[model samples]
Structures are given as C-alpha cells and as structure tokens.
Target: MSCQRGQYVTAAVVTAGAISGAYYAYRWYQENATKIPEQWTQVGTLKDIYAYPVKSCGPVIMNKAELSILGLKDGWLRDRFLMVVDEKNNFVTARAYPEMLLVHPSVKSSVLTLKHADMEPVHVNLAEVVTNQCAKTARVWGVEVPVFDCGHETSEWISRILDKSSNNFRLVYYASHGARTLRAGTSKIYRFTKNDTGALPDEVPFNLVNQASVDDLNTRLKETQVTPRNFRPNFVMKGGKAYDEDNWKFVKIGDNVFEIIKPCFRCILTTIDPETGVRNVNADPLETLKTYRQSTEPAARRSAGSSPRMGVQMSLRSAPGGLVKLDDPIYVA
Candidate 1:
C-alpha cells in the first residue's frame, strides 16, 4: 500500500507539471503567436459631437455625443448629405477642386445654411428638402457611390447659391445621419440646429483627432497659419495625453461606443479652413499622408488602393449634446 501510494504521488506530480507547462505555453502563444492585433487598453475617452454636412463644410456641432460599437459616430453619413453635383449628378469634394473648399455649411433646427464669409449666407429649409428611397449611382471624392439626391428645391437652392448655369446638381442623403442612438430626430435625415445638439450619434463612421495629426502637418507648413477646423473632424479630442487615441479601437461616451472603420484620407480640403472658407498654406495634409497610411490593394468603395486614407469612422451614438467628462474610463468591450 505504501509503494502504491508513492507511485500515485509521483504520477500526479508529473501530470500536474505537464498541465502547468501546457497552460503557460498556451498563454505565450496567445500573447505573441498571431499577427492579428490584440485589444488595446483605453488610456482616454473621446467625444464626437458634430457632423460636417459637405465633405469639407463647416461643422454642425452637437451638445450630447455618443459612441458606437463600430467605433464611428452615428452622425457620419457615408456620402455627403449635401453636395453640388453637375449635370450628370456628378459630385465634388475639396479633393481635386480646392475651390469647393471655400463653401461652408451651418445646420440649424429648421434650415441648412451655407457661409462663405465674403459671400452672403444661403439657407435651405429643412422641411421642404426631400429624399429618395433607393440608392442611385453618383460620384464624389473619386469614389463612385450609389448616391440618392435630395429634393428639387435643394437643387434650385444650390443653383442660385452657386450662381452657376444650374444644370442638374442636388443634395445627397448622408446614410450615417439617420443612424441616431436617441429618439430625438424624426428620421435619419432631420435637420440639426444648435438646440438639437443633444441628439448626438453612436460613433460616426469616421474618427478625427484635432491636435496630433493636423498639428503635425501644420508644423510642417510653418508659414501657413491654418486652424484645425479646416480639417473638419466630426469632433475634436483635446487636453488628453498626446496620441491617446492612436490605439483606441473602441471608446464609450455615455452608452455609445465607437469602432473605427477606415483611416480618413487627407485631401486638398485640408488646405482650407471650413470656417473662413479661405485658402490655407498648411503642409497639404495629403502630401504628408502619401509617405504613410497608404491604402490596401483590394480597397473598399472608391479606393484605387493607392493614395493614403487616414480618417476612420466609429459608430454613431445618441446625444443631448452632453459633455464627455475628462478621463472617462474607456472599456475594451
């Protein structure tokens, strides 16, 4: 009986040792085995509280903001909700045509307003504006899109505002705008005013950082005294540790969490501040991006899989235009 007991003890010890070794090895593999990135710890929180109607228009600031699971604000609409398309319904952005950078938009509760500082403000009634049911084909930002145009009134309004011959340009529905996390707006296409800031989105499909990247570019263009607003990020995350958002794949604002989809690409729009609608000499944010942040071969929508695309959208969220408390703990969930 004593000998049997000794054998049992030895066998149990060896088995336990093997199990322990295996566990340790498994942990090691999980830590360093795969190329897939692991969840990065949240060191800070960011609040996205506005939507830029035009691809590079002025911002429609929101008071309460939410984070989305996909990591983009709910306010982000894929195609610019408002645009000046040509005769064939072709679209435009600040990308190739830097002149378009001069146009700025301001959204109020009942109207969509445009500003050019030097030019008078043009307002479009939010109520009269119409939308389409199915997605149609259009092009903006070099990306061919299945875009739907807004109302005929919107086209007329734009024609007069631009003072062009007026062929067949109109507004497009921003798909992301309808993605609301609250019960505020009647539909996804409702107009926003300073008062409606409370209805923020989950996470806009795109995430923008004010200070770091843009500032970095500004430094490169020392002579160009451009404001970060020229870049028109959905929200500006400042006063936190530098680059706090670099690894932030997800963050929560109230009940909203955001998942970053793709990196926002820099365009000629960066050369102009949406606020002043003036040309900026900043280091052409696009020029710097070309060095890095290049796109993949099997690019998504408009990707030639060339030039760099940096801004990434998070999911949208609901908002009362609430304040995001500083140092708000962000979970990786």
Candidate 2:
C-alpha cells in the first residue's frame, strides 16, 4: 500500500509541476504578447524641415510642415508638386542642367514665384493653374504621371532660364486627382507602401538625412564638402551618431510616425553643389561614399549596384495631417 501511495504522490507532484510550468508559460505569453518587442529610443532632433516646391530646384525651408501621403506641405506650398519637363515630356532635373538648382521657388497666398539669378522673377497664379490648365502626362523615372501644363508664360520662363537657345522646356504641375503609378521593376525591388506611388519624386515621398552623417563625410572629403541640401532630404536631423539611420526601421516625430523604406542610394546628383549648382569635378562625395557605403544585401546590391547609401527614404505610417516641426524630438524603433 505504501508503494502505491508513493507512486500516486510522485504522479501528483509531476502533474502539479506541469500545471505550474504551463501556468507560468501562459502568464508570460499574456504579459509579453501585449508588449512591443522593441521600445522606441530617443535618437535625435529634427534640425530643419524643407519642402522642395519644384523638383531639383530649391527648398522652401519651413518651421513646420504638415505630413501628407503625397509628402510635406504648408498652406499654398507643397513638396515636389511642380516639375520642369523637356519637350518630350521627360522630367528635367539638375542632373542634366545643374543650373536648375539655383532656381529658388516660393509660394505665398495664391502666387507661385520662381527666382533665378539670370532672369526676372516669374509669378504663376496657382488658383488659375488649377482651374484653367489641361490634364496631361509627363514621364519621370520611366513612369508617366498625370500633370497639368502651367501654361505658356511659365514654359517660356523655364525654357529661357534652362535653355535660351530652344523653347523646349515646360513647367508642369502634379494633377493630384490622377494617380501616379510606380514602375514594376522598382516596386519589386523595394518594399513600398501602397501610397508610395513615385509622386513626382524619384521614389518614395519622404527622404530624411542625418546631419551628423554629412558632418562625418566632410571629414573624409578632400576638397568638395557636401551638405544635407545636396541630398535633397525633406527632413534633416542632428544629435545622433553618424549613419545611425541605417539601422532605423521606424521613426516618430511629434505625433507623426514614418516607416523607413530603404537607404537612399547616392548618385551623381549628390556631387552637385546646392548653392552654386555646379557639379564637383572630382566627384568627391559620391566617389568617396562608393568606397565605404555600398550595400551588402543581395537585393539592395542588385538594385543599387555600386551606389552608396546615404539618407533613408520613408513613407508616413501615421495618419496624414500631423505636423513635423523643427526641434521636434525624433524617436526610432
């Protein structure tokens, strides 16, 4: 009888231990399931906010800008909503005409103004452009996007500034009502959100650069030092380790949250001086970055080739209309 009792006691203890272990496991899961695996870490501060009214032209520096699926905006100004295109409706950038970078664009009330060193400031009535311009398509990065012709005067102004010999260039406005599709090859290469439709930009809507990264690169540069402006990022951040953004997947600024899509690959565009619109003779930054910053991932390497990674391309994860302001604390996860 004692032997049987001992067997029963052993079985009961075993059952009890199993029950305790299971209970603890369940409790642990319950606690952890509701918690985020990665906590947000304070990384940096947004030093400057820029909205490029015209692609590859100049930035309209803002104290604060409203986040949109299309990108950053403030009242009458929007980011990359306007572009200069060739006679063939192909997008023209500072890449072809480095002088385009010197063109400063600004908007106030209903008026869009373009100021260049060589020409008189030309003003376009935004209200009129919206109402009177006809819908058309323009090719950018091999994708055709719906746009509106900003009429003859603006076209002549742009042509005169960009190419005085031929009146072939035209100014076009993004027709927000129409959809801009991404190229299939590009979509396959990068994990892009549904809203990342190429929208006048080369790829994603938002680009962010670490100022410390630029400062770091300057140390390596022999003669030509580049700035965040040369990268043409919408957001510039400081107070972080150089190239800290490479590890970031998501970032929070104020009430806005943005998903980092991929590292922005550096191109010859980075070799151009933002202030002077002149391409570096030695290609200091792009060439230097190529030596150290090439992607190791197979897919990224296939897509980016030897292009060096610099700023990060992003898409807004939070609801549109959140304001991202200068001096805002940036948190990354």
For all predicted structures, in order, the TM-scores are: 0.57, 0.87
- Error of model 1, residue 111, in angstroms: 3.1
Model 2 sits at a Cα RMSD from the real structure of: 18.6
Q: lDDT per prediction? A: 0.46, 0.80
Best of the candidates, lDDT: 2
Model 2: pairs clashing at backbone N, Cα or C within 3 Å: none
Model 2 segments beyond 4 Å from truth?
A: 1-38, 177-179, 187-189
Backbone clashes counted, model 2: 0
Top candidate by TM-score: 2
How do the residues 1-333 of candidate 1 rate in per-residue lDDT, one tens digit apiece?
A: 111111101323446534643454344334323222244454435544456566544565555443322122223221235555677766655554454556666655535677664556666653333221344555543434444456666566556545553534576543322222333322232222221211122223345564555555556553555555665665566444543454455555434344444445555666565544455554455566566546543534244244555444443323222234333444433
